[model samples]
Target: MITKGDGMGGARRHGGRPDLVRARVQQGMSQESAAQALGVTPTTWARWERGEQGVRASYRPRMAALFGVSAVEVERWIEGWSHGETSSWPTTDLGDSSPAATVKSAALLWRLEMDPSRRHLLASLPFVPSALGEWLVSWNYGTPAASAARRGAGRVVGLADVARINEARKAFGQMDQRFGAGLVRPVVVEYLNGTVAPLLRGHYDDRVGSELMTAAAGMTWMAGWTAFDLNRHGQAQQHFGQALRLAKTGDDPLTGVWALAALTRQAIHLEQGTWAVWLARAAADTARRAEAPPRVMSLILVKEAWATALQVKSAEIRDGRRAKQVERLLTEAERAYAKGTTDRDPEWTSRFEAAELNAEVGVCWRLLGEHRRAADCAEAAVTEFSERLPRSVQFNQVHAAEAYLGMGELEQALGTARAAIPVTKALTSARSVDLLQRFSGQLEPYGDTVAVREFRDHLNSELIA
Candidate 1:
């Protein structure tokens, strides 16, 4: 609704880690001086620039404001630097909000996600890393009682905060912020290890606290999804368990279904197809019994269909038929979505969408060697997903890249993959990174080529930048 881009003039992250460090140098700041200011080593900073390390919390703010340029602006620059592109779509403004305006500007910022030109608006604002970390504490039970109370009035509104956190978390999930797993995985881990559990155990009402615990647990599981996406299987497993407990505490059946479906998908991704189908079936059953919304049920079915397709090896020829049928099912579910039907429907139907199902099917088809169909399905997914998810439009880009690569269009694949790099810089989810990494790994054979190399090098150097 509100578009603001020009104000981002000084809000660039310098376009890559190397450029950031270089900019500090250009400003005449010596390595020692820079390290002292950010509280890190010259070597550590260099490694970060090289994408060898995660961007530490302590350094981001000071480094971002160093040249009177917002760290976000530098992050913007890093995308172009990483992908070696002069311009990219994801670097647009996310509305006209300043760092302090984030909580107030949530809705406007949400809308900015679709407006590609204003995409970088959020990143441009130098978020106080400490604030971002503590923001969760308000909703997370782990925060000290006084601290949580301080944020809220007398009693903590953990329930409401949990719901609100879910809102942010979904957008975060949809965006899969990082193009690679290295940066986002740790951020999620930090959130999980630090904020989520404490919130679950913190004092609150039986009803409100239960609901809040469910939300936290669900979000906690989401952190695992990020972990799984990042290939941190062990940590992801632990998170999933934690999510289950929290979901149960809240007596939220939908949350349970969410975790189970994730497990099913993970099983399929790991090639344990049988387990995938079994898990999906169990999840679906529970979802059906529990009265989730229509949308949620659709999502669960979509997950089941995809997992089923993968598990059906010998039945592969007919897999296409099943996939088509799944698409139809989701459409039906969508029609029922706005009717307040989810409160009446099965528990698993709350978060379903045709676009997401399409994306899932596209991946399943690609894995099944149906390249032509995969391309078609992926293209559709990219269109729908991008329309719905502005902040993380790049998620579907990975599937699109895979389809392009699978179709043997090297340049097209490379182009799409390269395009994804810049868009991914602002995201904070390991899931997005995992998808991008998959696409990049596919392009690794193209590493020697100029395009691939540029993308690789630029992304590697984006940490500090």
Candidate 2:
């Protein structure tokens, strides 16, 4: 069984929580009944009462409701029961900039994700937009020490081990892009916990260790991207933070920038435009500091454009200046992208080619109310993306359909949307499903039309099946 401890000899001793037992008894509920009410097994509940396991933050409110006490009181009781022991509950905090701390936190996160029960609590955690500021500040200024060789009980790691991780990341990343996160995320999480975590604890020289950390950071970023695609925002945020810390520990500024860009994408998706812009800017600054390749700079510029477009979308009035700013950023992104690939471009940069750039530009145009340009960009993206990339194809198709709807071409919109239905059905991405649902919402005004009605009927049926 997975044990709850700080991984630093802070494991909880056998200490019983008389207060919790009293609360349950006062409610006249057996342990089994309480566990059932709380949607956990009896053993887990018992562990909580016995201080063998710490209660997750997400479950505190439910426990409060069950015991007719405030959530704070439940937390106090838990703390009191623990008798000043360090709670081993998984946290999203990046911890200190130390290499050892980074490895410990990454391992903890992977374990939390691998545990079925803990993963459930993780999914329920809320996304905190406010946390972005602190994270960005830390990443921007925090300078971690260079990774050095470590003496450990595990096997010695070498360059070959790091290469294996990079290879696996590529294979898993391809699956994520084509099949969506729902199918690939769990496997990636398991791999992190079972394979990468062990290698991190193994002995390796500075060169091997740094390369290993960089490779691990890439995989962690992939895990975050998959979680984001699956709409697990909390999980995504934690993974991204961990990836950033890993990159810092590895002394890989470009990978750190990549993590920052992922956070910007999440912020944009959450509609925290200001935070998105800040993150994107930080990413660009870091890229320039690292002298990142033109392709990498292009990716960061597009993210900034997307974030700027969001700000424009949220404005009470059409902000022409901000709209123009977005256009300028996209133009710059195009120019940088045109500079083409270089030897310095990382393997991950290959995925953000013309199709991805156009798709993102299409989104910026859509947000700016330029439906004609958005439609053209979306169609170009759709044609450029390979059939293997079903999620991207469906996302762009949805954008195309939305652009048609904006243009009042209901038939064209319906046709474009219908084209995405098959791919949507096959993919497991929550984002794609959500996009289609949003498109359906846009069709509410045309509900009375026969074609719209029939299309909605077909879409609904396919979505449900």
Top-TM-score structure, candidate number: 2
lDDT of 2 at 2: 30
Tens digits of per-residue lDDT for model 1 on 1-465? 112223322222323356666787788987777777778778866655554444533445566677677645555443333321322322212122121121112223223333334433332332122222222222122211111111322335556666676675655554453243444444554454445434443455556655565566656576667667656554455455445445544555667677777767677666666666666666667667776566666666667767766654436355667657545644554454445453355323334556666676676677666777777877786676564553235766767778788877887876776666666666554566566767767776777888778766765676236
lDDT of 2 by residue, 1-465 (tens): 234553322234356666888999999999999999999899988987787776665677788789888543565566553312332345545437666777888898888787643565466555777777777777877767655466667899999999999999999989988888999988999999999999999888888878888998998898889989988887898888888888888888898888999999999999999999999999999999899999999999999999999999999999999999999999999999999889999888988979899999999999999999999999999998858688899999999999999999999999999999999989879999999999999999999999989998999999998
Q: Candidate 2, residue 320: CA error in Å?
A: 1.6
lDDT of each: 0.54, 0.85
Q: For model 1, what is the alpha-carbon lDDT of residue 441?
A: 76
Model 1 bad stretches (over 4 Å)? 1-206, 312-354, 385-392, 425-437, 440-465
Record all residue pairs in model 2 with backbone atoms less than 3 Å apart, i.e. clashing: none
Q: C-alpha displacement of 245 in model 1, angstroms? A: 2.1
For model 2, the stretches where C-alpha displacement exceeds 4 angstroms are 1-88
Error of 1 at 137 (Å): 33
